[model samples]
Target chain A: MKQDSESIQKMMIILSKGTLENVYAAFVLANGARMEGINADVFFTFFGLEAIHKKKLEHLHVATVGNPAMHIPTMIGGLPGMEALATSMMKKEMEKIDMPDILEFLEILTASGVKLWACKLAMDMFHYKKEDLYEGVEDIITVGDFYNKSQGPGTHILFI
Target chain B: MERTIAGNTISLNEEGYMTNFSQWTEEVGKELATEAEINMTPRHWEVIKYLQKEHQDQVALSIRRIGKSGVVDIKEFYQLFPLAPLKTATKIAGIPKPASCI
Candidate 1:
């Protein structure tokens, strides 16, 4: 039946930015898929590796510079503490909406059975070892391995 | 819309969630669970009861809230209902579909 092909069975989200907004967007999408009875996987690469890095995950900041949505002048947005101010405000709003912190969200994703993968190339480029990644990460895999694991008729890949 | 469930005609929403909670019975829940392809255990009943209580008190339902509800954790909740636990469980509980995404 065409129904099988029309329905979304899996989501493969690739996160390539270290910004807090991007990381949360990827996490929420992956978690939302699982909540809807669909399988999901997140592949962290490039600057996104920071999201799974044990020591850096908690300190991610919203990108205020060059973000027109921030509504502040670019020069002002680039000032010291601007990103922190924006990040803190965003965090407060997220909490108001019952969104979990990055660490807790990772735990929830793991508990919800969303597989998390770290890119080998990015890990090596950043000199991050497996132990340096979040404990929930399933493995450090190459791009080819990620594509291989994510294959399916109804599977969709998204880059963020 | 009205549909027959467990031999009882029930009022339901467009998404098939029950519109009247009073019409719900354990038997209806059983049949709904069967339709959702879940075999009910005592554990499943417990979560349904918790959801019913929350709905009665007008508490919003979300995966995050359910995980923090102390009745069941997220992992076991997924295992219990297996697919779309919140929506399926709420449907069986005869409550309105939750608008929560988390």
Candidate 2:
């Protein structure tokens, strides 16, 4: 007989930067892993702190200005006589995708019970007070604190 | 899965923004509508709009070239798009069910 997940197998993650894609990737993976009954931990630090900044998460910006991906939409941003038609097409295409905004993504993770942590010393350097942190932060800990959690077999650590 | 929309069929890819929400929201939205007696609003539309643009931006768009960044404040979001009397806004917004509710 096989042991249940509660008896074996653990996965963990650490998020050190707060970019839309990075956070998205981390949570998506964690959520998927959890659905499969694995453990996951995301450690937020540095620029990554932006996602946990209560005042900022809702306002987190995607890298549209200089990023190559921004060009596709604008490629059709203003076409000649077909501009209106093109605009309509763009709007239509937009409706068919399922993307969670930053704030909502965080909500989903917390809602699903994925453990989230913040680096204490990093927060100290930025002079970030805990109250400034976003809702549902599990705890604030040092690198040593995170290492303690990352121990044991099957623990996975990732900086996204 | 592929779904048919207004006049065209939309393809669901693994990479699109709100890729998860866009694919499932309308179905859930419709279910919620029937159970709760509510309708979708424009603010829900805007947040998703921002999400789509940001998703495309993710492939390569950065603020320097795209010339725009930041999300609209959530409070003002309510004013522009009013909520359903029974708190339908949260449902359409894909707001996670509250902890207590779970």
Candidate 3:
């Protein structure tokens, strides 16, 4: 399709990290894009699929393993209670800015017309059923389908 | 910088968005539209009016919100403003650049 001269009509964001910061960035950018009148979609894969999973989403943690900010050795990330501590701290900071929790943010994005998709391969590997995901997920599509749907004039594909 | 419209000095930011919206007039709108290379039409005026009102209300303006306001649908908004609808329309309407714009 031929695009209009200057408007960005479509945006595709691929979420590969379930970390709080990454998920937050994806939603912020998607919301901003939709606010600009662009059609936006987010495809969740691998660890990212956990973001849309109902049970997992509620307990999202900041990835401490291999995270340079953590400073401590990566092995410390495997210790118990670290994830819970990080999750709480992140949530507290986000609340200061009036940003909703991850689950609420996802619902707001969906209500605002941002398409959500789960990767089929990830679902199969993780054994995630459609019912296990949040209500707004459109479908379990392969990466190829994502590429095909994202193809068009002024389409922006971003991987995060 | 400023543009004199109808004997009124309308102050504008360095980026050309109006700093004082109260100084905006139809003549000023026409001049701004021309600078953006858009020929003024009633439909364009509709959007410009709506944008000005939203700015006064301190509402965050977006294409979807504009469409929901019944001023115009997203497709028609793009058609009216051509490239960069929100940016161009807001500029023509004498409002600040939308936060969503780069």
DockQ of each: 0.65, 0.02, 0.12
Off by over 4 Å in 3: A1-8, A73-76, B4-9, B14-16, B24-95, B98-102
Q: What would the per-residue lDDT of candidate 1 be over residues B28-63, giving only the tens digit for each residue?
A: 999989988899999999999999999999998989
TM-score of 3: 0.68
Residue-wise C-alpha lDDT for candidate 2, range A1-160, written one tens digit per residue? 1134344345567676554556667777765554334566788888788888898776543443334554645544334534445434543553344445566666655644568888898899888988998777889899998899888865667666
Candidate 3 CAPRI classification by DockQ? incorrect
TM-scores of chain A in all candidate models:
0.97, 0.74, 0.90
Q: If both were scored by lDDT, which would come out higher, candidate 2 or candidate 3?
A: 3
Off by over 4 Å in 2: A1-8, A65-96, B1-102
Clashes of each: 0, 29, 0
**Model 2 per-residue lDDT tens digits across residues B4-81:** 544334443332112244444555445544544444456555554554454444433211111123454432332333
TM-score for all models, in order of appearance: 0.97, 0.49, 0.68
Give the TM-score (vs. native) of candidate 2.
0.49
Select the stronger candidate by TM-score from 1 and 3.
Answer: 1
Pairs of residues at least 3 apart in sequence or in different chains that clash in candidate 1: none
Top candidate on TM-score is: 1
